[model samples]
Target: MQEAVIGLSHLFMTVFLCCFANFMVIPAITDVTMAALCPGKDKCSLAIYITGVQQAIIGLGSLVMPLVGKLSDTYGRKFMLTLPITFSIFPLVILAYSRTKWYFYAYYVLKTLIAMVTEGSVQFLALAYVADNVEESRRGSVFGIMSGFASSSFVFGNVSTRFLSTSATFQVAAAKSVIALLYMMVFLPESVVKYRTESTETDCLLEKPPTKTWKLFKTLPSVNDIICLLRTSPTFSKAAVVAFFSNMADVGLHASLMYYLKAQFHFNKDQFADLMIIVGIAGSISQITLTPILTPLIGDEKMLSTGLFFSCAHMIILSVAWAPWVPYAAAMISIVATFAQPCLRSIASKQTGPSEQGKAQGCITGICSFANIVSHLAFSPLTALFLSDNAPFRI
Candidate 1:
């Protein structure tokens, strides 16, 4: 038990570092895009279109995330975890060196390519790692705790960004990413020992066995495999439905919110950081404290519903903000709204056995990735239209 806790602590530290590196740049990226693509303009159609295109391509690449997860079940979480963290560093280095128009385009291209593999893989792998070590009964709280660490990192990253210059933010982020990768490589232990043993035995059983590399690819989860997994459990299917729409709303809000704020209120990087800090602090408190207490009492289902309801409320408030402070007020809703993901993930994790945790989480993440593609397609145009001078109707 002590060993498990120690392993989880290492995992949490890795998550915090990686997330801090990633989130620190969110506020600065918008300004960079605006300056590069449309200098002095808050609303840039080119920036929106480019972002949409990049998101679409990344979503398409993320379809392979499940494959990586499935492979982690055969390999090890520590090994799989290294790939994304390492890939994440390259784009940040590019941006750290320069944020000029040509350099921004270079960063954009590399970032899109890297994000396909790096985006959701870290979180999903971490969740699967937790599932490997945690008991079913305690999975919800543990998942919440893990998310809380990420939220804390989000808050810290944004706070750092609030003070750092734009160039310094990217440079610091790249450094942190390197640190995260190294820490994981050195400290995090493998969690799938039993699965690795089973895989070895299975490999030995084959007559004139193929290479492990070929077998790994051959065993990649297919469409029918995902379908079977979904149809095999009613609970999982319901969770899949929730995951799809929840992620759809999330991606839409993420894609539009910063641009909307910049256009609607002329928010700069510091204002963006302030807004994110509110959401992060609220989310961190809810996940770290409220979730563990409330989930067991009210149940994950009720918690999920409560979260989704408030998530909608917050988005509605943001859409119709009368004052700059309204967005900050709406961000407070994340205190409860943040309950959605950990609960949803907990419920999903319960549907699969220990050995299949990676596959199951990957499938769920793939569903969310598909939602990202759809949300980008639908929301990007609307955001561009509404934010542009010639809008069909004003909000």
Candidate 2:
């Protein structure tokens, strides 16, 4: 137990550094995109459309995330985690070096390509790692703690962004990304040994031949594999439904919200960072303090429902936001809404065995990726249209 706690502490630090690297650049990226594409204008159809395209392609590529997860089940989680974290650094390095128009375009293309693998894989693998180390009874609370760490990173990153200039933001982000990768490699221990022991015992009992290294790719989970896993329990199927729609809402909000604020309220990088800090602080406190207490008492299912309810309320509030302050008020609802993810993840993790953690988490993440594709397709054009000067009908 002591060793497991120590390992989990390392995992948390790795996740914090990686998330900090990613989150710190969000406000800067918006300004950079607008500056490169539209010069001085806040409402840029070109920027919106380009962002939508990047998101769509990333979603298409992320359909392979389940395969990555399955591979982690075979290879070590540390090895698989290393790949995305390493790739993530390159995109940041491009922007850090220069934010010129052509350089921005170069960064855009590379970022889209790399995000396909790194987007959701890190969180999924981290959850799988936690599952491997922690038992089922305490899993929900532990998941909340993990998310708390991530939310804390989000707050710190945004705070950094609020103070730093755009160039410094990306440079610091790139440096942090490198540090995250190195930390994981050096400090985070592999959890795959537990799964390997289980596999070896089953193989010995059945007299199974060792799998060849060349055939590893052939063993990737198929459509049927996903279908069968979903059918494993009714609870899992319902959780998948929740994951899809919840993620869809999230992606749609992410796709439109910043642009909407920029267009509607003339919010710049500082304001964007402020809004994110509000949400992040709320999320961090709720996940760290509230979730651990409430999850055991009310259970993950009830907690999930409650979280989703608040999530919807926040979105509705944002949709009708009249004043700039309204958005900040809406952001505070994340205190409860943030409960959705860790609770949902805990529920899903309970439905699978020890060996299948990666596959199960990966499958759910793939569903969320599909949601990302759908959200971009459905919301991106509408966002561009409504925010553009060429809007058919203005509110």
Candidate 3:
């Protein structure tokens, strides 16, 4: 009962804190990029470059995710999870306190490197923990609840940004993560045990003893391990494909949306924050109510694909938004489109046996990291060029 409670609470708070930090940062990323790269006018190109550079650095860091995931398999989740979360703290504080261009550069380097260790894995680890604990048939609802936790927290984060300064938001976000780290250290239990370790055959009685804490640091899974899993597992392969494309769209959207909207619609921070709040509500409500009902009825794959189709629609609507209200209108698409990621995660978790969940989720995270590099680079330049005065279309 205590373990269950810990897992549930951990997921809820971790999702909330992560979403809070994320929402806190979304409005600021563009501004920070501008401040770091170009103080006055001519900010667009440098901002784009900063965004691309950040993603590229994180992409390099992401190479460790699969290894970390596999390490969770060998060393255990608690050790794997704690180090990244600890590494995460200082960077947030550094970013919050940034006053100079050099501070910005330091923040960027620390963020890119620190985040590479935890970026794709935190939520993945939480989801993997769910898979470790819950029964197979009911995992979708749990995943949805987790997603809803994120969205709901995003709603709160948006509210904070409405009144708070960028520095305040970053500080509060850092504090929230600190609370989470303390909570995990005190209460969270290891979901994986020696007897329950994943293996190829049934009646698999082979379980390696937990590696020593120092030894855990050196035990890293290679890129080949990730590739071999993809090559060997058909279900994992298909899920990886869906995750790749879906993340391509998501990463591209995240990197470009704020810059695009502010450039075209002249949205200030408050306006951008409100748009996100609306989108969050739409997703939160849907994932909480609609996805659970739909996942069991239509199946995760079909539901995921449907969500992706609507995601494409959401992007298209944003592209040609003619009026201020149009962006808000596009937010309604999130009602259905919110199903994509959680569903993909559920599908992937279901494909793997108990032992392989960490590896699988880590691979998905690695795919996301790779896609982030590509999408940020691709979208930053394109969005900048499109919004430039010299552009042909004049968006």
Candidate 4:
């Protein structure tokens, strides 16, 4: 029994680390799959459109993402982390079976719906759990380590799924998720500290029981509450804007990268996946090795500034140059940027009280989601217009 308890504790730590890693994978998976599945007639164009549409779908989910955070805060964190995984099983099965373009669209829509709960909320809850459990002195290291695992998972998942047949990829993804679910069920504990309240009325109104997660988001927080929160908290307001721009830049770069490859150097789907895998691995290393060491040394503000500056420089270089080393240079810069993410997240966490972490994270995700929606809507048509077979510049 003691051994079993010890084993479960270890499992919770693993799940805590890997849950966000799993969320980090959605983009890498979508990128590789669209590259494989999109029709060959104007393949680059179709791929961008498909990716954009998918992003827009996920963006809509992001708009409602904070509800999950708030519910988890009011109720419990473990349930929030588990809810999305439970909901995701069916859509992934559908995604696995889908072949036609209409089926692909349907699957993506389902994915978007599930992502609303999972990508933003699950991670927010998980981070709250971490903040609650880990000491402040070590929180940065813990977050850095979790980010490393998540990025590593992205690298491996991209390589493995990208190489597999679409059917095989789906099967593998389903299996991975099932394993994750089972681990959570058998081993993970409720990480939230117990809180006592007087009235059942508030509980009845707010508490979203784990079993009835389907109804979790049925009741909405008022628009006035949102506006008041934004106005009252400058940190939340500024974080929201930062979240939006950051996601816009991230999604725009991702959606355009494959086309940029084909347009500039004429690489195919497999080659692009390989490059992504390499870049993902580099990012994983940077987040693991460089972040923990650098963050404490330079602090979040200076570190984030330096990271963003380098990332912008790389984007400019990619926009202009198509040399053999361009991808390598770009990857290095992006890895530095990736290293900064967890640090920024930790800074955001410190801006709010412990109880409000979920809402704060949700606000950030919601803003970013809106940004992603805009970028996707604009990037697809813009890419098509700017880069045809006869265009002068690749970007």
Q: Distance from true position, residue 113, model 3, in Å?
A: 1.6
- Candidate 2 lDDT tens digits, 237-337: 99999999999999999899999999999999999999999999999999989998999999999999999999999999999888889999899999999
Candidate 1 global TM-score:
0.94
Go through the candidates in order and give each one's C-alpha lDDT.
0.88, 0.88, 0.76, 0.63
Which is better, 2 or 3, measured by TM-score?
2
Candidate 1, poorest ten consecutive residues by summed lDDT: 200-209
For candidate 4, write residues 1-395 as lDDT tens digits.
23322333543454543443343344345444544565443246666677678778778777876676666666667767777767766666765675466766676777776775565565556666766565555556556666666667767776775667766666667667777777787777766543324332122223232343445445355555456556766665765666667778777876776676666666654566566677778777887788778877777667767766776776677667657557756776667777556766676666555555566567667777788889989887777666667566544
Better of 1 and 4 by TM-score: 1
Q: Sorted on TM-score, highest at the top, how do the candidates line up? A: 2, 1, 3, 4
Error of 2 at 20 (Å): 0.3
Q: Per-residue lDDT for 185 in model 2?
A: 95
TM-score for each prediction?
0.94, 0.94, 0.90, 0.81
Q: What order do candidates take by lDDT, descending?
A: 2, 1, 3, 4
> What is the alpha-carbon RMSD of candidate 4 to the true structure?
5.5
